[model samples]
Target chain A: MLEMSQVSYQVGEKWLLDSISLCIQPGEMLALLGQNGAGKSTLLKVLSGECRPASGAVTLSGQTLQTLSTNRLAKQRAVLPQKSRLNFPFKVLQVAMMGRSPYRGERYQASAEVVYDALKATGTAHLSERVFTTLSGGEQQRVHLARVLAQIWSPSEDNQARYLLLDEPTSALDLIHQHSVLEVARKFAREAHVGVLAILHDLNLAAYYADRVAILRNGKMLCQGEPFHVLTPATIYQAFGAIVKVMRHPERERSPLVVWTDQTESQSIKTGKRSVSQGINKSA
Target chain B: MLTSIQMHNSPGGTSCEAMREITATHRSENVDAASSVAHVVSSRRWSFGIGLFVLLVVVAVAALGVGAVSISPGEIISILVDSLGFPLAGPLDSAYQQIITSIRFPRVALAVLVGAGLAISGAAMQGLFRNPLADPALIGISSGAALAAVAVIVLGATLLSGYTAFWGIYALPVAAFLGGLVTTFLVYQFSNFNGRTSVSTMLLAGIAINALTIAVTGLLTYMANDEQLRTLTFWSMGSLGGASWDELRVAAPILLLSIVLIPLQASALNALLLGESEALHLGYNLERVKRGLIVLVALCVGVSVSFTGIIGFIGLITPHLLRLSIGPDHRFLLPFSALLGASLLLASDLLARTFVSPAELPIGIITSLVGGPFFLWLLLRQRRRGESW
Candidate 1:
């Protein structure tokens, strides 16, 4: 289990996460939802031990994350940062091997069964030797997922549940790869029994795959529950200011689908303006 | 789930993607497998193939015919063969043979060592810095050596008299070595903040230090007497005029030691071709590598400068030419650079000797005239595309 205890993070005097606390249980997938600047990614980084929190504690099992050494924390949790910039031509297998760094005796040790399994599971097994930087966005994400999956398991200790914290994992994926990738993450939770937390911009994907949805608005937890309970019309407007209709997915009823089935109020009617003002607004 | 995969699989969809992925994989794997084979084979063969050993024999023969005596090649060989206590068919003059053995031979050997040492140091420094513009002279190492030699000449510091003074030339090289070491140490210390040395920051530090040392050298030149001025100017222009057997003895060990250190470190330099972070992940301690190389290059530069003053391009040009010809594999690059460096320096020194009859020109003048424009061309070539990473 990974627990955040009254975690408060601020950037330049503005709180990004205000006195928040939550415990992520093993064998569960949590979706973090928020608007563009809602601190979802920062909170993920804070939990990943990439950024140290100013106050309070993040505990892995019973041990405080603050007390763990860098390598120790790396072994316990794997984070897929938003993107990687590698201008040099490193191959896909080589990058996937980098995920096994915390497990190795030295720099790059011999490959283990777990890394191989991670590569196969993500369907990136065939692309193993292809140059990583040359791949398209979707292909790169698959390779990255393979890397993180490899890191999220190690034989070092069995006392703690490994955490896979991804920042926008599905943003660049196409429809089919998106499903394939999420299925891989789901397998990690159900089959591998690891704790998974991801920041998602796509609400439909979240509602489809998440065990629970945690709504963050203006850097505070607005609500946290199952998708059906938290994803309502009022909540959508309150969080995003968009008028969206919440309905059951046609194929998967338990999952909620958001339909932006309504149009906007005229700007002149609302603001009492005589003429349209910005960016060729007369067409609208 | 397996049934769903089959159902959604368009006739040309999944298999097409998989096939393309496999082909790409095969191409990359082929490259990796090829490089790994090349690496293993190269290692198993000769580790460094110190080609300078071969060049020494050639230059030694060439140097015999070079002096004002104008002895034929056969005569030089006859004189050499005549000295191993063989009874001469005709008769060998004892004094002429002595001059050949004691004077010309050691001078030639010192020339070979000096060229190989400085050029190899430049190659190693370029590899270490991963910047093509690196040279023994570029990083203030030569200036430090220059400052020390100038100090000795201006101060009239002499340990021996007359012929002993001419032969006991090891003092200048020693002074130059000490100055180069200090400057290298200062550059390393000043450029660093945390444990790691930033390459750009290090380059800037080298440039500043280089400029400062040049300014100080100019001031020293201003204060010198006419005789002192001529003496320091000759040293700065660089030469092999003072190379005695004693001087060769001192420079030999330092050059040999540098050749050993850099080529032995070819794998480390290859690892550095990747950026610092990747190198660190590959398990090479970047700080240790950087410190090790800086010290190594400094040692080589110090020793070379001691003997030859400021012989310019051998270090910078050798590695680059080797790279153009043999590619940038440091294993090949290191040894090839040393060989090509030794050969080129000998040729330049030969030209320096032959340029104005009995009045010898400094070898450094020849290298700078050739090396400077070539260096500018490389710098411009590197800057043609995007900014350097």
Candidate 2:
């Protein structure tokens, strides 16, 4: 298990994460949802040991995160940031091979096999030989996802649990790729017993794929539970400041679909005032 | 899905259309062709290494034989073998042996070492900064060394007479090396904030340091005597005519150490191309790697500048050309940069001496004249291919 207990991170007088506690079990996918500045990325960073919390602790398996060597920590966890600024023309295979750096002196063929498997898992195997910079943004995102997957491709020799942390992994992807990437994460969680934490913007994607969902509002946990229980209309409005309606998915029972409702248009019809476009025209 | 509909309705739809066009074109290309290209890329790395080694050997030998008192290749080989305590079949000319061993040999050897040092340092700097245009000069190493060289030249007989007497011929290079290291340290310190080094801040700091050092050097030049000024001019323009066995004894080991050590960070540099945070997350101790690289660069470049003055473009262009040919894997790039850099400097030194025979043009002039046009052509080719720098 990867656990964060009462972690608070502050910059000057402002708190980016306020006493947040969360845990992700192996063989489970947890989706983190929040508005901009709600500290979703901060929470991920703290958990990944990129930043030290002002108070409290993050533990991987049973060991405190700070006490672990970077190489040891790397073998057990991998992080994929929202944007990758790789300008060099490295081949995709070479990029993926970098994931196996933590396992230094391992046979080249062994690492290559792991990397190839990771590329296949992320549906990027065919693009392995292509220059990474020439790939489309969505393709690049998937390739990065593959790289992280290859990092923890196998359980460590000590049998410690592995974790994967992704920040907005699907933002650059298309609809199909968004689902496919999440599906790969879900498969990894289920089959490989990896703990997967993904920060997601699409509530419906989270509803369909994640085992549980957690929402943050103003650096505080607004709610956390099964997606069906936590993704309520009132919770969505409270977390994002946008009115939304939550309904059951027609195809999948117990899964919720969230649709944003325009308050201006609805209120205009009720009060017999100008429509949204007319308001825009008046402002212009 | 509702999300897909909203995405289409959003203002990003135009970019989405463009992205689809790109994807369509990409899908049309053969996947097998890409795999085959990858196979060729991996195989070509070794072949390229061998080819560069052969090229360096040929260039070095040709350079050794093409001086004012031209010795034939066979005689050059015989002289070299005789010096190594292996007497060849023919009688070796003592004068030819003396010239080759005492004069041209050290000069050529220094050229190779200085070239490799500058080139490998340049490769490492480019990788560290993650900027293709970065070189040793970008960090003010060359300018700082120049300032110290100028200072020693101007002050060697006056206020610094005691200091010069203490070190004798070693005074100038030692001062220059210390100067370069100090300037680099200041730049690094200025850019480091809250335990993180901002590469942009480092670049800006480097610019500021370069301007200050160059101004100081100019002041020193204004204060110099005519003889001092003449020496400074030749030094600044760069030359191998002053090369001697004693100077090579000091520079060779330092340059060789740098050439060997810089490539050991190949994996870290490769990871760094992804970005600093990415490299840290990949299990590298980022701070240690950055500091080590800075020190190694300062050591090699400071020594080279101390000995040869500011020989430009070798460090900047060699790794770049190699990257275009073999990709930017530093494991290959660093060593190849060293080999190619040595070959280029040897050839440039050969031209510098022979082109205007008996009255040598500065080797720095030759490198810039050749490297400048070649670099511009590379940029043009890259632009034509629709590749971004």
Candidate 3:
């Protein structure tokens, strides 16, 4: 389990993240939702040791995060940061092989079989021959997924509890791949008992997938609970300043759908001649 | 997850099983010229075998013949054989034999050693910085040595007027060595962050340090009296004019140590190409590796600068030229750069002597004149392709 108690971060003179408290249980899929400046990345960084909270602490499996050595921390918790840019023509296999970095002992060379298995698991087998830099964003994300999986490679042992932290894993993904990637993560969490914390942009996707949701507005959590409890229209309005309707997904039985308020306003606009008034009301 | 079968697709140029590239970089356009060129060029190990092999033989032969009174290569060999107490047909003249054995042999050896040292230092610095443009002089190491040499030149005889001027010549290389170390240490300090040297920062710091060293060298030059100024100028411009057996005692060891250390760093340089984080992942402790390289380069450069002043370009040009022909994998690049550097410097030194004949041109001048254009060409070519290095 990963637990953060009143974790906060200040950079320069401003607080990037204020006092935030949350707990992520093993096998749980926690979706992090926030605006552009909502400290979503900062929150993940604090948990991952890329940043330290100004006050309070994040503890993993009762061991304090601040005290764990870098290599040890890497082995236990794997983070897949968003890709900005890479300046190499690193082959896809080489890029994927880097995931095994933390596991290397004195002469650490990850076994070929282990790398092959991780590649197989992530279904990036076809891209093995492709250069990493040449791949499209979605393909790159899967490659990154393979890398992360290889980083936490376990031969047969299940005793090792793992933490997988992803920063906006599905942002650039197409709709089908989005669901496919999330389903893979969901399976990894339940079967592997890997705790997952992902920062997400799509609220409906978060509601459909996350076991629990934590919504942040301006660096502080606005609400945190089960998706059914936290996906209300009022909270969405308070967080986003836009009215939206919450309903069960028509296809997925347990999934939640958040239809925007503009849909309703446009429907009324279609019935009446005064579309300009409707646009004004919607803008307001 | 790349399947087992597909993982071997992009063949790594430098795996543990890495061997010499049999891949010919140049096109076989006009196969006869290329073939004849290859046929005459000695072997595939061009820099290691051909360049050094030919230079050694030519230097050995030329050194025997180049004194005030020339001796034929055959007569010089006879003199050497006569001196060993193995009688030759007609006994070799004593004075001519002494001049050849004592004066000329050591000077030629010193020339080779200094040339080798400067070239290897340049190549190592290039690899360490991951920039083909960096040379020994680029880091202020040469100026550091020049300052030390100038100080010893100007003040040593005046301060200890009792001592013979003979000992004063040794002061410059010694002072230069210390100065070089200090400058490299400072360069390492300014550029290091989180125990890893940032190559870009290191290059920038090298520029700043080089500027400071130039200012200091100028100050020392300004303070020198006419006689001392003359001595300092000769030292500053660089030469094999001061070559002697005694100087080789120190230069040879330092040169040998660097030659041994640099080739070992090939793998480290290869890893550095992937950037620091990835290299660390590859199990290299970057800080230690960088510190070792800096010290090695400084030591070699300091020794070379002390004796020969600063020969430019051998470090920068040799590595880059070798890379154009051999490609950038450090396994081949490092050793080839060292060999090519030595051959280039020695050949240039030979030109510096023969070009002017009686009035010798400093080897440093020749290198800079050649190096500056080559440097500009490399910059332009890289700019045309985008200078990623």
DockQ of each: 0.09, 0.29, 0.07
lDDT of 3 at B171: 60
> Between the candidate structures 1 and 2, which one is better when assessed by DockQ?
2
Question: In candidate 3, what are the lDDT values of residues B1-389, reduced to their tens digit?
Answer: 21322244235311111111112232233233323433443256454446656766677667657746788888888877887889788766888888888877776677666666676677667656655656768877777777666666766667634432555555666677888888878876877775455768877888888787778778878878888788777877888877767788878988888878877876666656545543443445566778888888888888888878877777777777866665555656666666666667767776887787878898889998998998888878877965365
Candidate 2: chain B TM-score against the reference chain B: 0.86
Cα lDDT for residue B248, model 1? 78
Candidate 3 CAPRI assessment class: incorrect
**lDDT (tens digit, per residue) of candidate 1 on A145-168:** 877777765445555677788889
- With candidate 1 superimposed using the best TM-score fit, by how many Å does residue A211's alpha carbon deviate from the native? 9.3
| Poorest stretch of ten by lDDT in candidate 3 chain B | B13-22
Candidate 2 C-alpha lDDT tens digits along B286-311? 88898899888888988888888888
Candidate 1, position B319, lDDT? 79
Residue-level lDDT tens digits of model 1 in B1-389: 43465357445235223322321334445445534644554564344444445665676678767767776677788887776777569877676787788988777778777777787788777766666666778777888878876766665444323423563656566667777888877776875564344667767778898898888788879988898887777767888888888777788888888888878776566555544433443335556767777777777877777677888888888877766545555766787777778778888888888889788889999988898898777767656843244
Q: Which pairs of residues clash in candidate 1, taking residues 3 or more apart in a chain or in different chains? A: B119-B314, B119-B315
TM-scores for all predictions? 0.62, 0.90, 0.66
What is candidate 1's CA lDDT for residue B145? 76
The C-alpha stretches of model 2 lying farther than 4 A from their native spots are: A265-284, B1-40, B156-169, B188-204, B387-389
**lDDT of model number 3:** 0.70
Of 2 and 3, the candidate ranking higher by DockQ? 2
C-alpha lDDT (0 to 100) for residue A128 of candidate 2? 78
Model 3 ranges off by over 4 Å: A1-9, A17-33, A37-251, A254-284, B1-136, B139-141, B148-209, B244-246, B249-300, B322-340, B386-389
Q: Is the docking of candidate 1 incorrect, acceptable, medium or high quality?
A: incorrect
